[model samples]
Target: MNKIFEESNQVALIVNEFGRFDVDSHIMNQTALSVSMLQGCICCDLQDDLVMQLHQLSKQEVQHVVIEATGIANPIELLSACQDPIISNVYEAPLVITIVDSKRLLQNENTEATETLMDDQIRASHRLILNKIDLLNSDEARQEVIQYVSQLAPYSQIDLAIYGEVKESVKHGQATIDKVNLSTSHPHTHYEVLSYDFTHPISHEQLVQFILNMPDSILRMKGYVQFREFPNEIYLLQYSGGLPALESMGDMKLPTTVVLIGEKLDKPALKNKLELLQFG
Candidate 1:
């Protein structure tokens, strides 16, 4: 059984676990208007039911539905929801983005658990993300991680960004919610998550070397970068087994933070390496 709303100009209804079932739909609509849609991170396990709910809601003149699959939750329901009411000209696809942080990877550091998580994600066949590389100090430590992630999933397009900072921008509406279109010049590999962070700052020459010497263990890297000559913020992405790329997002209000997501990530070594950058 489903409750129907009178059809209006509501283009889409983003499904989120904002309130308990006790609240009425009118209250739900009011709450939804006040909240930012991206603030909610969808748990992977409930992706199915969420998708089904989205479908039911779509029947009321809503044209598209967006669902976030943030963790290891299976995306079958999400995938199925996108396939229904598939028009020849317009195909609705559930954009699946898998987000994992370095803390989770570093919990045991170089253990089977970390490897298992990465392995499971590769097997699932979805989008990739290596978050939180800003915790590290130097590029060498980050490279070690880049090398390892590239070997795990060669087909998935990966992006590295400081999750805590950039993610908030999406949630807070500081930046427009635009589909991030990744370039194909660089092959999909672990190397995309390569970056450099310094408490003080470094020169452009040093930054270039860091990019060139990126290791295979580090898979992705992205965050605010500060250089002496190039006193601008940079968003960096390095991929093992492929070409490295860097882009500029002008200036981000967020602090410098990078994230690395991969298999068998060296946690202690990473933390020890990050400690070196503590001195300002």
Candidate 2:
């Protein structure tokens, strides 16, 4: 096996042959180095030459490759071109984290796609990143990034960092080692959790309409909904870009209140929409 490390790019790419893919040593080292993005997945739609390139690199020894595609259809092509490539079992996979700080420059639509691509970089498992906090001019902007990331990646872990670097408290894979127990440190500010309540039965159509037409200011939307026909029952709705409704068993007495938190949600406008829903 060959290992290729380049300080100029701060990346290592690993390649492996089918017969001798070293799982343990290779991946552990990859994690210890730079933030990595793994691209080969048997269940995914990756190209074969890209796979062979990655295989040859593994045989030679490179660990990670950089991919910044604008119009490229094959996302895995960039990953397959690294030096001594290492193979992983994936079940005990190392985390692939992308650190970003948009400070309102990144559009809401772009935020979802950027995160989706980062998560897609590793198919079998989720990917995480620390949205740099200090870069934002205000505390509110930092919190907005956090809320947006949470909705975009409900299953993945997120850490808050400041001044354009990952925090020492949550470096490498330490934050997501167990995933369920991950937490962020509030070095400069405290975040408050807000809840909006409702006292009426919500219809599926109404709920869908509200989400589809939610203002650009809202970053996250989640809560339970109940239609009159399904009384004494409730359906949970979680949405980022689209919608996923899960059947849930509960008192169904709660309103279809969606707690929307973001950087730009005009409370008065949102309140008007909610008030209308209550009477309708």
Candidate 3:
């Protein structure tokens, strides 16, 4: 999607955990705005920030505003924010696209909970992209996958992709902006969010070990950190889907805070571990 935005010379306003816009000058130059939200589903926890960013973007002479929502986010809840009277006149959620991992969908032991979330995402989308089709061995297998998706999202226009490539026709389809009834409850009501503000710097080694040993239930962990070893540099820490990446942001006046979003998080245990990593 970032590639599409770049090729078409369209501006995007990304909302993510690492405060990526503040750290990367290239991204800042390419994007109209970048704001960081708390580590949770954007639909519930960070809807206000999303709306504020949209309102700000409306003031600019931008042709498009792309919001890159998190994987765990419910698109319906996020789109509901566009109905706000303040921005409804200027903005419209004409389309919602859901991307699915072909490999995951084909897995035999996919949990019931996982299926429920996937179904909700599919039902909400106007279009669906069955990505990573290259993982399947034969056309027959692909057809099976398509059959499963059809059952889940019968109305959505389906597209297949390998290595993230998709047809232009599917990408540029026209959509109608219809108003939807907003719901107060969210699918992630059971999930837990742990947020902490670190006044002192943390030992880099300890931070790495902490992330490496993070509980499997923790779906995402991201925030800004000031490391003792790299006093001059502020690092953005992001961990998702068993992979972690750290990027250096030369310097910033932002708070050294981190937020952990997941299910059934043991808060006391996590807080104790973070306390040990703090540099005295």
Candidate 4:
């Protein structure tokens, strides 16, 4: 979505509690315009907040608006909330895009509930992007992912991406939606998000080690950091499916915070380990 935001000169409203470090990084480089954070998940706590944001954006000269939902969010609930009488006249959802981690899907331990959740996401998407293809070792391995996703969402157009980057043509095109069937009954899946703020600088080596030893229940983590050794520069850390990527953000004025989203997280144990990285 950051790629789309960079390509399209439009306003963006990111809905995340721990500050959208991914969107913030793009805003720092001025590739995006007027990015706003709603500070809660749109699927549950912040539906009204989303309406307010849309109403505010309606007054701006923005041609387009993008709402980046949380990983565990049900997009249908988000869309239904958008239809509220308050902002329905002002904003219309023209497209919905779902980006799938190809590697994660292949490696996921499939339970009945997990399968349902995955299918719901794919079935609701207008455009499906199979991302992290670079992680696949061979052409056959990549094709296997495509085949599996095709069975789930055969109607939607599939595009392969590497490093979360999609082609400009695919980014701008409209998806052909055969139907809009919103499921009334959805299985309740509890996902907890934990946000940590560290004012004191942390050791880069220690941070890497912490991430390496992260619990398997922690599905995704992203945030900005000010390492003691690289105090002059801020780094962005993103971990998904056991793969961690850290990038230098040059010099930027952003908070040093991390947001962890997962199921059955051991918050107390995790907090104790994170405290060890803090400077004395």
Per-model TM values vs. the true structure: 0.38, 0.35, 0.64, 0.83
Two-way TM-score contest, 1 vs 4, winner: 4
lDDT of 1 by residue, 1-280 (tens): 0112233344444443321211112223342311122222233334345545654564555554444332322333344445555332243444555564544454444344435545555433344556676654667655544444444444445555683333321111111112322211211222222223456544556556655654545544434445555566644433322234555545543345444444445666654454344431
Q: How does each model score on lDDT?
A: 0.42, 0.43, 0.69, 0.71
lDDT of 2 by residue, 139-187 (tens): 6776666666565455555556654344633212333333322222111
| Alpha-carbon RMSD, each predicted model | 15.4, 19.1, 5.6, 3.5
Which sequence of candidate numbers ranks them by TM-score, best first? 4, 3, 1, 2
| Collision count for each candidate, in order | 34, 23, 0, 0
Stretches of candidate 3 off by over 4 Å are 8-10, 18-32, 108-111, 167-184, 192-261, 266-280
Model 3 alpha-carbon miss at residue 65, Å: 0.8
**Top candidate (lDDT):** 4
Candidate 4, residue 3: Cα displacement in angstroms equals: 5.8
In lDDT terms, how accurate is model 4? Answer: 0.71
Query: What would the per-residue lDDT of candidate 4 be over residues 1-280, giving only the tens digit for each residue?
Result: 4556566676665544433344354434365655455455676667677777777778877878777776766667667777889887877655778888888888766445555767777777777888888888998888898778676666667888887776422323234433645583553445666778887889988988898888777878988888899889988888887888889888977788888877777889888778889853
Give the best candidate by TM-score: 4
State the local distance difference test value for candidate 2: 0.43
lDDT, residue 242, model 4: 81
Residue 176 of model 1: what lDDT? 14
Over 4 Å off in model 1, which ranges?
1-48, 61-63, 70-72, 80-91, 106-118, 122-126, 165-280
